[model samples]
Target: MGSPAERYTYPSPLAGFENAPPLPDEKNEDGKSFKNPPRDILSEAYTTFPEPLENGRRGAFDVHIYYFSSNKAYAKELWERIRREFPELRIYRFWDHPVGPHPVAMFEVNIFTPAQFGAFIPWLAIYRGPLSVLIHPNTVEGGEGVSHMDVERRNHSQRAIWMGERIPLDLDLFYAMGS
Candidate 1:
């Protein structure tokens, strides 16, 4: 093995692009140029749901719902599946939105009846998979005061997108933009 000195040598610039950052002045006053926008080196971008899923005032007897999915197609498939399997449950998504980079679906579940909401928990426990990382707050409200931000890169797993005659069980079948 090489000495620790050699192994832990400080990071040095790559051969050609040493000390280089994208040039900002490479564009015109029309504000339309550039191969790509400047990357967010010191920043982590953020995005909010298309709409907040909320219910009536707080009370043990109040309706309780969840903004369940950030992914539209998954949400629809799940909802349709649930509706068929469990026809008695009352679930609805007032606002349907798809957030890029997030494959999870989200929709507020309107629990207009507390008793019904209680019943929904059992089914949720069983069906909740990786998607269950989603949460149902006691009160659905603005994220400003919320302490947590759960952001995940899109899952390019087998189930990522549903298209074509055969459901792709591998990534090689998926389209990579401009394909």
Candidate 2:
């Protein structure tokens, strides 16, 4: 029999799949295949809003950090550290239970500018300490009157980045907010 390494050197199920026909490229005018596309093209698109801070607005995005009440001590310590470290940013008090459309207790952190966002995200990534964060932008412009449920769905399902265990949210509460 062959050596152990040689014996187990079998091809993966998708070994030859990479060279197969690629999916249709939506951005291309001719709907051509995206075979061996550039690395940038394969990556997900980043979210951007149009002229968010044009008129002296405070912010364009709000980030929420979710934690269970059972770990109140750790959550409080984390919250205090954030407040102390980033005094310029706005941080809200901790909620013990569900608030707004959120199904679990969470605190809010408001980021007013791209500079603040750039500084805050990386810091949180390293120091979050057993917390799940949900980051969403404030897309409401003019008087569009978009419901909170729409925002929550877009954030939790598609846009928001999760740092830890993603908890289920009560999207229905967003609809009830208008009542």
Best TM-score among the predictions, by candidate number? 2
Q: Per-prediction count of colliding residue pairs?
A: 14, 0
> Any idea what lDDT model 2 has?
0.68
Model 1 per-residue lDDT tens digits across residues 78-115: 56766786565555553443333223234434333344
Off by over 4 Å in 2: 1-58, 142-157, 177-179
Please provide TM-scores, in order, for all candidate models, with all chains considered together. Answer: 0.29, 0.62
Model 1, position 144, has a per-residue lDDT of 47
Worst 10 residues of 1 by lDDT: 150-159
Candidate lDDT scores, in order, read: 0.37, 0.68
Q: Pick the candidate with the highest lDDT.
A: 2
Q: After superposition, how far is residue 152 of candidate 1 from its true place, in Å?
A: 24
Write one digit per residue (lDDT tens) for candidate 2, span 47-105. Answer: 33344222246456677888886676888888899899999888999898888667888
Error of 2 at 69 (Å): 3.2
